[model samples]
Target: MIPTNIVVHQHSKVLELSYDGGAIYKLPFELLRVLSPSAEVQGHGPGQETLQTGKRDVVISSLEPVGHYALKPTFSDGHDSGLYSWDFLYFVCENQEQLWKEHLDKLALAGLDRDAPMTTKGHSCGSH
Candidate 1:
């Protein structure tokens, strides 16, 4: 297994997630929504992932720790389904540059930017 570590560097308007295994993911609330690991984003299975779009300035409103292995994140737009587990977090970190690049690629494919329009709907975007 690959090594991993997660650190939350909350910003004034953005929430930064750092990994010790190499890779720093600066996840804004909106980006987090689109990248949510829930069915909305992850979809039913492989090749069914719904690419997240139109999120640039998304900021995490809350970061609640579920025990010690996962996180229950609540975004400003009210989307949470991505229970960021330590293992998952480490995975993201280990592949930060690649994942972020893919994220940007998808954003570009959707004609979205880093500061897109904000939505009003809010819901659980994470797991227990």
Candidate 2:
């Protein structure tokens, strides 16, 4: 699955992925950060997802291609272990709204701020 075009908008902090069928997806850096496919975020098994917070202002520092099927994005926050496969990226694009809403819900449940550190003076996600 070759994306016809992949453009990273540094100014807008978004990644635009366009497929041959004319579907285009605009994904924000913060969204990508929170939904990273790395084990650090996804954990090794189900029910072990680590909630990602304090990424409201995160930006993509660079996007590196992995052979022929994935992208490795390095974020400004220093996270770079996730290898975004073509299928995974497409999935994110197709289910962006729902995924984003769920992320927000989880944050609310944990009382975490998207823009503030979890360990900030008064901010907490109720996670130890």
Candidate 3:
């Protein structure tokens, strides 16, 4: 289900998506940034994911439509690679709570904090 309306609430730091049947979702900027599907965040394969940190204050600087299938948002932190697909957005909206819990669990397991600064790490591929 594609969102009928998309609003970037700068003050609230959320991307509001309105769908049919009066369903609405407000995705936080931090959530979007941390869970970005881009390779930079997700990595090239399983177990290679890069955990995102220090994105609590991230903001969407611009939002662009990607051929009617997705949205490309340029974040204030200069991240613009993730292309959020319609289905992917819907899934995130529906599973927001669970996803957040899982993310927190991972952070705890890694002995990391969400507000901590992201450290520069070398990737196996030798590429950023």
Candidate 4:
């Protein structure tokens, strides 16, 4: 049987979820984003995942529950894709530590930092 409780430790970056099957899981924020199902990050086809960088300090501003088994997460960066399903949330929470480490490794190999400065384009950025 799965448990039925969902809790988040924002400061520690931990997301605790309980399933109705007597199972509980705790996941990290970074891991969740890295494994987001959004097209911009996951791509439109196989072997086409776009790495998300400069999100180290990103936090979950809001977690709006969508229906009874999904979530609409609003991040501090204003990116709100990647609807998290029940199974997906369970997966992440179950394997948080390892997944987080892997993300760190990937960032290191790519030589990118979540806090790195990125030049914004468009008229809003002022002058070309």
Task: Identify the leading candidate in terms of lDDT.
Answer: 3
CA lDDT scores, all candidates in order: 0.62, 0.88, 0.94, 0.71
Report the Cα lDDT for residue 51, model 2.
Answer: 87
TM-score of each: 0.64, 0.88, 0.95, 0.73
Give per-candidate clash totals.
14, 0, 0, 11
1-128 per-residue lDDT for model 2 (tens digits) = 76889999988989999999798989999999999999778877797778888887888998999999999999998999999999999999989999999999998988877776744333233443
In candidate 1, what are the lDDT values of residues 15-127, reduced to their tens digit? 45654555555544554566677776686768767666555556677788887677778775667777877677556545666777888887688787646664434433353
The lDDT, on a scale of 0 to 1, for candidate 4 is 0.71
Q: C-alpha displacement of 35 in model 4, angstroms?
A: 2.0
**Residue by residue across 1-128, what tens digits does model 3's lDDT show?**
89999999999999999999999999999999999999889989999899998999999999999998999999999999999999999999999999999999999999999999999886655654
Q: Model 4, 6-41: lDDT tens per residue? A: 777889886777776677677666667667877757
- Runs with alpha carbons beyond 4 Å of true place in candidate 1: 1-31, 110-128
Model 4, runs deviating above 4 Å: 1-3, 20-23, 114-128
TM-score between model 4 and native = 0.73
Candidate 3, residue 78: the lDDT equals 97
Candidate 3's TM-score reads 0.95
Kindly report which residue stretches of model 2 are placed more than 4 angstroms away from their true locations once superposed. Answer: 118-128
